[model samples]
Target: MTDARVPDRIAVRGLTAHAHHGVHGFERENGQTFSVDAVLELDTAPAAAGDDLTRTVDYAELAQRLHAVLTGDPVDLLETLCQRLADVCLADPLVEAAEITVHKPEADLGVPFDDVTVTIRRERAP
Candidate 1:
């Protein structure tokens, strides 16, 4: 629920991309700017101690992977996008949990807001 309760997260914030994710035909036809923030829960002790890139989860590659999933397809809902991103983050062996948020700044909503975002969190299966 809160960052203080989630100590195992490797926060990856400010990931931006272009996607055609919405319920309208125009939205699907014309992509919009989307921002993503992913917090991957993993034990970085090994990597921290060994000082090796391979010893722990690489945030750079993770960002690219999340970007691919976000822009790879046209989803009708932000919830679906968040779920998929969570799934991808949990796919890694070192990841124990993840929280993914997808924000649409230029959404077609008539409301006067900066953006609309969907956030989801999940843990790996035992």
Candidate 2:
């Protein structure tokens, strides 16, 4: 058997949406910006060789779906949100793995910080 190797990546960055995702009541009441970055791992050979849009992931549709997730429901933790995003990325059958990142810039940590983010990676099960 051959070893599994990392696949080629298609990435979307700086996708931002306003949502109520936090433990604090105030946060839920007044939504804040949540930025996301998704990296999809897939074998692009077919798409490239055929020059077929259908052979590859439709990123426009993917972005819309990701936006829907960001605006859909309330979550208490970035980890949960990241998982959801990962699920969306892997929904496309072409994708072998996904890396998701959620950024909460306005988190109420009581200390000065540039930003807060959570990143997670998930792979399709064999």
Candidate 3:
């Protein structure tokens, strides 16, 4: 018999990174800061009861992985970055699904804007 329970959610927010990723040449050469937010759907019940870090996602390590993607390559669109970020999150076999948002505060638009963000949600393939 299987429990077939929905997993608890774990969220990591406001993880910032400086990287050379953008559409314009200056934006790519000079680099800009990006803020990432991620949510992982996974079974945390075991970790909660046993007090074991191994049973759940290690967010610090996950942050490092997310940052690596940001710093590694230059992408023209925030949508691309969002998908790559989602891929990184879903790489963990234990993760059933991932929701991520990438925020670009310094977008090179002529008009004033508060912020620009792209969000994505992905579920593990069966």
Candidate 3 stretches greater than 4 Å from native: 1-6
Count of backbone collisions in candidate 3: 0
Candidate 2: tens digits of C-alpha lDDT, residues 2-63:
96776889998999999999999999999999999999999989999999989999889999
lDDT preference between candidates 1 and 2, better one: 2
Off by over 4 Å in 2: 1-5
Q: Which stretch of 10 consecutive residues in model 2 shows the poorest summed lDDT?
A: 1-10
Q: lDDT tens digits, residues 1-126, model 3?
A: 998887789999998989888889999899988999999999898898999999889999999999899888889888899899999989998899999999999888899998999999999999
Candidate 1 similarity to native, TM-score: 0.90
Error of 3 at 31 (Å): 1.4
lDDT against the true structure, each candidate: 0.87, 0.93, 0.90
Q: How accurate is candidate 2 locally (lDDT)?
A: 0.93
lDDT tens string, model 1, 1-126? 655544466888989988888899988998889999998888887888889879777889998999999889888999999999999898899998898988888987687888788888898999
TM-score comparison, 1 vs 3, better candidate: 3
Best candidate according to TM-score: 2
Instruction: Provide the TM-score for each candidate, comma-separated.
Output: 0.90, 0.95, 0.91
TM-score-based ranking, best first? 2, 3, 1
TM-score of candidate 3 on Cα atoms, chains taken together: 0.91
